[model samples]
Target chain A: DAGITQSPRYKITETGRQVTLMCHQTWSHSYMFWYRQDLGHGLRLIYYSAAADITDKGEVPDGYVVSRSKTENFPLTLESATRSQTSVYFCASRGTGRGTPTQYFGPGTRLLVL
Target chain B: AQTVTQSQPEMSVQEAETVTLSCTYDTSESDYYLFWYKQPPSRQMILVIRQEAYKQQNATENRFSVNFQKAAKSFSLKISDSQLGDAAMYFCAGAQGGSEKLVFGKGTKLTVNP
Candidate 1:
């Protein structure tokens, strides 16, 4: 697809296990972000990358790690998944510089930890 | 840190009618941008509209428009001629000019009655 896409649309994992969600965008947006959506809490930024090799943490970055080795790819990893980590993950991207800062999101990955 | 707040958790409107979803955001940044995102049951985050802090005119896209009050830090979305397809969860998000992170509200679930 030409837009952002996430792999493993749905996943089931056990506690203490590791899981990774992949995100890819063809827009070549300079900024890529990951967010988790939970009940009551709409969506919170998990991590963001300004560019390849440049990443930063967001409000809820604990227990989650992200790396952006390429501008088109930004993957999120949960080293040891917990029950509380069960949520829908979203990947978004936007162009940089002087332009519309509106971000476009992926279809989302639903993760369930048992 | 910038925070977005959505007071309405759920709203219902008859098809062909108009409905407004309210959103409030707090930010210390001088220049920022606010956005409205629609997430249907498919879990795809679709950009509905956007407003820049520096622009006095409210942004509109088709049936969707925003009443952005920059001074009050309030940004609300008005969906005119609400259709059954408009029945989805609406989220408000904000990002500063130089920041790559986006803060999203809890979201409001809108239901359209046909």
Candidate 2:
């Protein structure tokens, strides 16, 4: 079903440069989220959107921006990438069914900031 | 704010044995959700199982199951008949009612030995 997909599965960028990771889902889920996985730090939420135009800052939202212009696409942008920003980024989505909170995750984007 | 914790940094289980990965969380919300995700070397985050706070019965998917204790704020995953495919980093995550943002644990690296 290609439940969830991410673009540029791998990327390399220099410090102070801008980078964007793209996520798309086929389920048309009502919620979309961005997370970065790092050693010892686990996976930290970066940003999330409740719907097409409703976005909110997550625990690690600083230095990052997100926009959900469409229900299936949620893109995460790093204004100025830093060495600390080098991590595996994941995107996930969930349907709006009541009492159901299972999230479907994408393959993830591996970003390397030099 | 909620916090998830996985105290075990690594765990090992025999190919035909059972293993339990521990996870605990702190949250004031009475209605929240917990999830267990598996990430292999391929970096694909796969949902092994999930539990809803209101459900007393633990969730199970094939050989995977979860022990959900709402009062204790504990959600542990148990894998029976472990196979080589079971080797991966297992993550525990949580989210408040109706919230799309998730808090993740540091993860437990599982090794399935033959």
Candidate 3:
């Protein structure tokens, strides 16, 4: 309960359907990130939020939307999901500090699109 | 833009042996951070080790250590006394000192042979 958690550990949805993956962190870290892990592509950042209401696009932001209404919550939404979007989604949080700030990751949500 | 590269697609090591996973990166920033993350079958991304660019000493955690060559832009992970639990996908990542985004490499799948 003291770590980050992602909802819908496993999801299967049809293409073109809208889906939202939730991420909640109890640490209240200032930085939160969403990443998609695919074979041959370790992990690509989809979106990140520095703080409440402050979000930025990451490497692969297409077809994805993210919002951070609170410091502990950052949700990623697939407005129109595609088969290509099916992958393991990971949410990570990091505190603002020095000497290579460590990131805490949650058990990823595996999404499959048909 | 920074890019991380993991050339080895797969590797294997006998139990209790040692294995090294290679990683290379391209970045113009002088100050940054490097990390190695392991993902097991459970799909949980866990931090293995971290190295700061400005630090001359490599970082180690338990039996996992890094051979960091700043001039060569190489950060390789060496796992000693490998165990069955060490079998997983290991990813190398780089992040700028003050930036929130992390650039990740294509992971290397490690297999521990009996």
Cα error, residue B36 of model 1, in Å, equals 0.5
lDDT of 2 by residue, A3-39 (tens): 8999999999999999989999999899999989889
| Structural RMSD, model 3 | 1.1
- Encode model 1's per-residue lDDT on A3-112: one tens digit a residue: 99999999999999999999999999999999999999989889999899999988899999999889999999999999999999999998987565788899999999
User: Fnat of each prediction?
Assistant: 0.83, 0.78, 0.78
- Candidate 2: list runs displaced more than 4 Å: none
User: Against the unseen true structure, what C-alpha lDDT does each candidate score?
Assistant: 0.92, 0.91, 0.93
The list of candidate 3 runs beyond 4 A from truth reads A98-100
Q: Give the number of the best model, judged by lDDT.
A: 3
Chain A accuracy as TM-score for every candidate: 0.97, 0.96, 0.96
Residue by residue across A9-100, what tens digits does model 3's lDDT show?
99999999999999999997999999998887788899999899999998899999999989999999999999999999999999976653
Best by DockQ: 1
TM-score of chain A, predicted model 3, versus the true chain A, to 2 decimals: 0.96
By TM-score rank, best first, the candidates go: 3, 1, 2
For model 1 the local lDDT of residue B5 reads 94
Q: List the residue pairs that clash in candidate 2.
A: none
Q: TM-score, each model?
A: 0.96, 0.95, 0.97
